[model samples]
Target: MSGFSPEWLALREPADHAAINAQVRLELVRVLAGKASPKVVDLGCGAGSNLRGLSPWLPAGQSWTLVDYDQRLLDAAQARVARSPLSPSPREGGGTSVTYRQADFSAGDFAPLIAGADLVTAAALFDLVSVPVIGKLADAVTANRQIFCTVLTYDGIASFLPEHPLDRAMREAFNRHQQTDKGFGPAAGPNATEALAQAFTSRGYRVIRAKSPWVLDQTFERLRRELDQGWANAVRETGAVPVREIEGWIAHRLAAQDAVTVVGHEDLLAVPV
Candidate 1:
């Protein structure tokens, strides 16, 4: 899969943190109750935002293995995690320890990475992978009996305030673009949540899913603008809609007053039954 820039990852981290489903996180915490030094593997650990956001809720003395295809991102994640107050302090006994690995799991086996992990997690990742990739991950997690949690699997829901005539078309086209090869075969895209649920449930795992939508308003103007531009680009790639119409749609969206966008996502937790 293509690597995301640190800048884009940084821009989205706050929204990602804010959008986490409280109930799903609580369930994850519940499953991880007794381990003083739990082992976690974070796939595609972009800037380690997931760690920064989730570490405080986990057990003390946690050890994390952060894996990504890009060494630069891995480095950024390590540095960011080390500095974040939300992460466990770097003091002796109760401090959290982190290891970074550069690997393109898309092209090779990732089973080894999660071999002894108590929990395997990823954020904003599954939606870009193929169904077979998800199945492979499910098999690995189930075989190891590791808890699995993934958040921000887009659900094809994009609603913009002051609705425009071309919004639906743009959204549909963009979703189609999402399914294009993202270095993991045909990407699951908006169908990722259902794919994940089915994959785990069929393996006798109990699955919990909750909505984790990004409710962007005026306060998030920069992110909102960037998101709109991204959508427009994806829609253009599909060629399912005219370029002029897509451009006009984005212009209207960006220029509109008090615009709000709700981009739907889901958080999934799969625990051994």
Candidate 2:
């Protein structure tokens, strides 16, 4: 409810899936390889995309707690888990089970869900949380001795080909704007992955980081256009450029339809020391 729309999330799900570091996911799956029916808690599990995306990489007996603030998203998530072929089916080994919870992790109490959890995971989430809250999550992971993995956190790398004069300025301003509160006082913005890794490391956990950037090509014109519009909106909101310039930038972006853009992201996996 407080985050992206289902339409946007659905539109980006495939890119998110492809952009996830496979090696990182393989390592995570390896860590929980021997566990019998691991209990996983996914923070901000919007529409169960992560579940569908990563479940196959994991063993069959995977059980997930898909937590989010919106009931509609949770319902959609439930429906997806029930119907998606990517999800473990009934006849499959052990199969996969899911439970939904409506709670905002931004400023909500989620310690209860971490208890007895084998893995605490989230995708595209760390950037939206504050430092103290991330520290609290680190403490909980240590207390429960659970694995923490987060993916698709923007790392401030944005590229547009046939560049415009305002490209760097607009991106820098937008990054600053990203720090504006998204429910967690001054979000980490581009520094999210580093902040989280540091939090777990200070608590004596070993962290693994991987690059998982989205490289949109000509084939992805629609997705790229939508993403560019989002950048335009972000830059506009920050008042970094005048409305006329912003419009011109947007126009240039659309004009360069064949341009390839790479949006950087990082994936993190932390395990107890």
Candidate 3:
């Protein structure tokens, strides 16, 4: 299993993430209504990023369960939550109670972990989860008549620097690799949003879908580097051409970013159904 490397965090670290994610959270809050505090489960809740964004809007009495298969990430998330002002202490208004579970949504059944939640959500998770697995999750949540929301899955396409020939080739190769099933019984990777939506709709979810793509410009240097690396790795994995040529392309592209245009991604927000 590929661990969540600092490289991943570096890519995710951005001032805009907090604001953009808050917007996504607010959208979910708008649709889910209940007088009593609702239970919430954040599947693949890495380091509690979404929790940080959602806690303010949720009622003080609401209960939360955070789940991630990675123990290191789960521990980190626990620590972050405990340190936040919203900690279960009375001073924080005691509006929300939180719990963290280290479990893989792919292997462990989510039904029990998320049972009875007014809302169950995942950010950038569905793209990595297989269709069969997603189907199971849809069944589990629908069986309980719960709402499910997933955001920001890759659409197997990303806009890239204009005038860069290698950029298009790399993206095409990576997207193809993303479509392969990674020993998970069912395929995941790219095109995940469409598949998940179809699964939920078929399972009787009233699906509400939206797009939230990342159109980061050269201003986002770190994100730009990560995107380049991601594309390079995919090109390497495919073994479609000479390794040296791919490396050369990556180095050249990275160096040429000053003038090269970059645009990539198709983000999707899918609600239950």
Candidate 4:
């Protein structure tokens, strides 16, 4: 919830599934290109992963502004940008022409900072925002005609060897948990994609939807562990079953020596319609 638990970040970064999502983000940039110097703003930038990923595709002279609620992530993102291949000013001329800003996207008016940017983006954030807030964002972006993209939304499919029923049960429960908004009021969870798509279409932007699903193979231990924990927590949160049963079910799946794959989808690419 706060900073993605360090263990979670460690396992997530090296995930093979992440590679697919990164590729989708890259393509999102390619589809919306037509500017001399685009001002790219990454909303809920989250350590600047999306920014760093977009650097190569973006114009060399282009500027970037990273926004997040956490200062710690902002600090780390700036440091990464300084060392990134796309650093605007090399040779110690200046430390990355990138600007880091702290802002709350849930309640505050976003048009002033984002209204005129060539592009605005976020990773794995759409499913977590409520419909009304997304409506406001669609209004703002439509007014400015900013290109927007988001990546890695969870679609809730988990499979392990032997095909246990618990896997299906846990996944559904987790999807429900994902819908529970953390602090930005009520959100409809994984279904946020539709709200975003509808909002953009109504405003007159041609939307290109791409699904980047994370399909993990059995060889990846880190991904297995992350999915296991995520499934367990989702089931536990519901208080619908006994803790011992959940433990036993998880143990059985992990103990079996076979390939396990969890499928999750992320939506990408929204342009002026």
Query: TM-score of model 3 relative to the true fold?
Result: 0.84
Residue pairs with backbone overlap in model 1? none
| lDDT for model 1 | 0.88
The candidate, 2 or 3, that scores higher on lDDT is: 2
What's the CA error at residue 155 for candidate 3, in Å?
A: 1.0
Question: Each model's C-alpha lDDT?
Answer: 0.88, 0.85, 0.67, 0.69
lDDT of 4 by residue, 117-221 (tens): 888877667777778888988888888878887666555544566677676676677777777775566775777777788989888887766666665666676
lDDT of 3 by residue, 188-216 (tens): 77767788778777876666565555655
User: Would you list the rank order by TM-score, best first?
Assistant: 1, 2, 4, 3
Worst 10 residues of 4 by lDDT: 88-97
Better of 2 and 3 by TM-score: 2
TM-score, predicted candidate 4 vs. hidden true structure = 0.85
Candidate 2 residue pairs in clash (backbone atoms < 3 Å)? none
Candidate 2 lDDT at 91 equals 30
- lDDT by residue for model 2 over 95-115, one digit each (tens)? 788889888777646688677
Which ten residues in a row are the worst by lDDT in model 3? 259-268
True-vs-predicted CA distance for residue 54, candidate 4, Å: 2.1
